[model samples]
Target: MATYNPIRDMERFADALLEGSTRGPRRMPMDLYRDGDNYLLTADMPGMDPGSVDIDIDGQLLTIRAERTLPKAENVKWITRERTPGSFLRQLNLGQGIDTERITANYDNGVLSVTIPVSERAKPRKVQVSTGAPAGVDSSEVVVSEA
Candidate 1:
C-alpha cells in the first residue's frame, strides 16, 4: 500500500500552479553514474545547438545553461506552439573528491556528456603497517589493522 504524504502533495500542487507563471524553462533530464574512478553525467537536450550550451564551474557548484530560439518568420502560422523555446538550466553541487579543474564535456546528437574525475588524494589507498613497537602504546602491544 502507498502512504499519502500531505506535504509532498501540497508542494507538487504549488509547483503546478506556479509553473506557468515562472517563464517555463524546463529542467533538463540528467543521468549521473559512477564509472570506476570517474563520474559520467548526461543530459538530454534535444534540438539544442552545441554552441549555445555553456558549462560553468564555480567552487563546487556546476552549472549548465543552454538556449533554443524559436524561428521568427512573419509568414509562418503555427497550428501548435507546444514546444517551448527558452533556456535550459541545471545546476549541481559536486561534493568533495571531484577534480573540477580536469572536468571535460562533450556534446553529440543533442546529448551533453560531462566526465568528472576523482582526485587522487580522495582515492582509496592501502597503507602498509609492519609489526613493530606500537607507535605510542607499549612495545609488546597487539597490532590492529582496519578492514
Candidate 2:
C-alpha cells in the first residue's frame, strides 16, 4: 500500500512552478579556469547524446547547448519522476585576448571540455631592459635620436 504524503506533493508542485518559470533553457553547471596559455572550461551533462550537443561563438559570447530526452512508455504509471528532460544551455562572455579561431571542444564520458587558447599578442613576454651604457660607450657620448 502506497501512502500519499502532502509534503512531497507540495514540494513537487513547488519544483514544477519554479521550473516552469524558466521555460526556455535550463542552466548546466560548469567550471572555468586558466591553464597555462589556455582557458579551460568543463561542463557536466550526464545522460546526454553526444550528437545533440552544439557549441557556437558569436563575437565575444560562447554558447553551449545540449538536449536530454527521457523515453516515454505506454500504460505505465510513474510513482516519482524527478529528472526533468529538455534543453540545457550555458553562455559565457569571453573578453579580448582570446584566440577564438582556434577554440576547440571535446565531449567524453558526459563531460564537455572547451579549450580557449590565448592569442599570441596576449601571451606574457619579457621586455629586455637596457642598463646604463654598452661596452666602451659613455653615457655623455650617446646621442639621442632627433625627430
Candidate 3:
C-alpha cells in the first residue's frame, strides 16, 4: 500500500482553486500592435460567435466583452474538459491620438482583430518654409538726417 502526503495534496488543491477563481471574465489576453496609420488588436476567442462580442471606446478606453454558451448533451459523459468556455471582458487604455469614430473590427478563424485609425492631427506633416520677404516690401532704405 502507498501512502499519500495529505499536506502536499491540500496545497495543490488550494492553488488550483485560487487559479480558477481568479480567471473570471476580466482575464482574456490580447495582443496589440501599431501598423503605419492604424493600431491593430488581436484577441483569441475560440468557440465564440462574432455577434456575441461587443466593442466600445469611450474617451481613451477601449472595452471588449464576449459571452459564449456551451452546447449541452443529453447523455454524454465528459472524460476530460480542459478548454475554458465562459464570458470574457477586457479593457484597454488607448492613446490620445486614436480616432475612435473611425475604428473598425473584424473576426475570422476564431480571432478578433480591431483596427483603429490615427487622427489627421496626429499624423506627421511637413511644414513648408517661405524664403522670400513680404511681396509689398521695398528694398530701398531711407535715411533722414537730424532735423
Candidate 4:
C-alpha cells in the first residue's frame, strides 16, 4: 500500500507544471562570451544524450535544442523521482559582425560549446596614411605633421 501525502502530491504537481513537459520547451542555463576573434557559448545539459542535441542558425537568430529522455523498465517502482526529462531550448540573437557560416558546435561531458567567429570585415585593422607631395618637389622633402 502507498501512503498519500498532500505535500508530496503538491510538490509533484508543481514540478510537473514548471518542468514544461507539455507547456513547451524548458529553458536551459548557458554562458556566452567573446574570446579573441571568436564568441564562445557553453550550455549545461547534464545527462542529456549527445545525439539529441541540435543547433541551428537562421539569419540573426541562433537556436539550441536538446532532449533528455528517461529509460523505460517493466514493473519498476521509482523512489523520489526528481529529475525532469523533456526538451530544452534556448535562442540568442547574434547581431551583425558574426560569421554565421563558420559557426561550429561540440558536445562534450554534458556541456555544449559553440564557437562563433567574427567576420573578417568586422575585425579591427589599422589604416595607412600617406602624405601627397607637390609635383615639382621631391617626395622625401615632404614633412608630415601630427595633430
Candidate 5:
C-alpha cells in the first residue's frame, strides 16, 4: 500500500492551476536570457498587432500586456473551439541590478523581442595594473583604454 500526503497533493494541484491560468492564446510564450551586454526577452504572439502590445517596468518587475481582436469569419460555424481571445497580462520579477530605463522592445513577425541594456555598475570592470616601478605609473605615460 502507498501512503498519500494531502499537503503534497494540494501543492501539486495549486501548481497545475497556476500553470493552466498562464496558458492560452491571450498568454503568449516568452523566453528571457542574458546575451552579452543586454538581457533579451523573446515572446511568441501570433495574430497580434505591434501597437496592441504594452511593456512596462516598475521597480524590479517587468510586465507585458497585450490584446487581440479577432476578425469574425462570415458563414463559418465551429463544432469544436480551443482558441481563446482576450487580454493578457504577464509579469516578471527582474533583479535589482537591472537597468529599467535602458530597456528597448520591438515586435515583428508575430514575435516580440525586448533588449534591456546593462548598467555600468552591473557590468564587469577591468582593473588596471601599475606599470611604473616605484610609485605607480605616471598619468602622462599610462594610457588606459577598454578592450
Candidate 6:
C-alpha cells in the first residue's frame, strides 16, 4: 500500500527548485533572551553588509530587515555554488512593559544585535502594608500581606 501527502510533496518540490534561489526574500535566524532589565536579540547575517541592515518599530511590531547582493555572472562554466544572496526579514511582537523609545540596535561582524529595555512601570517594587487606621479615616479600608 502507498500513501500520498500533498504538502510533503509540495515542500520537496519547492526545496529542489529554490535551494539556491537568490531572488526571493528569506527569514534571518535569530535568538532572543532576557538579561537583567533588558532583552537582547542576536541575529545571524553572515556575509551581509552593515549598511543594508535596518531596524524599525511600528505600533507593537518590531521588524528587522536586511539585504545581500551577489556579483553578476557572465558566460562561464559553473562548478559549485551554494550561498544565495537576497533580502532577509524578521518580525517580533513587543508586548507590554517595553521601553520602545529607548531601544537600540548595532551591527558588527555580520551580526545584528538589538537591546530592549524594560519599562520602569513594569518593574517589581515593594509595597508597604498597614494594619488598623485611624477612626477618622475613610469608611473603606484595605489590607495587604507580606507573606
lDDT, each prediction = 0.86, 0.91, 0.81, 0.90, 0.78, 0.85
Give candidate 2's TM-score.
Answer: 0.80
Worst 10 residues of 4 by lDDT: 15-24
Each prediction's RMSD to truth? 9.6, 4.4, 6.0, 5.2, 10.8, 8.3
In model 1, the clashing pairs are: none
lDDT of candidate 1 at residue 97, scale 0 to 100: 95
Per-residue CA lDDT of model 6 for 1-147, tens digit only, reads 346667876876687476445466678889999999999999999988898898889987999999988788999755534566789889999999999999999998988899999999988889987677765787465556699
Worst 10-residue lDDT window for candidate 5 reads 19-28
lDDT, model 4:
0.90
Q: Could you tell which candidate, 1 or 3, scores higher by TM-score? A: 1
Candidate 5 per-residue C-alpha lDDT over 31-110 given as tens digits, one digit per residue, 9 for 90 to 100:
98898989999998887767889998889888999887677788986653334556676888888667888889899998
- The whole-model C-alpha lDDT of candidate 3 against the native structure comes to 0.81
TM-score of 6: 0.75
Per-candidate TM-scores read 0.76, 0.80, 0.73, 0.76, 0.65, 0.75
| Model 5 ranges with Cα > 4 A deviation | 1-26, 73-75, 129-147
Tens-digit per-residue lDDT, 57-94, candidate 1 = 99999999999877777988665354557888999999
Q: Which of 3 and 4 is ahead in lDDT? A: 4
Please report how far candidate 6 places residue 83 from its true position, in Å: 1.0
- lDDT, residue 6, candidate 2: 93
lDDT over C-alpha atoms for residue 116 of model 5: 81
- Give a tens-digit lDDT track for model 3, residues 15-81: 5586576346645668988899998999988888789999988899999999877777788966544
Best by TM-score: 2
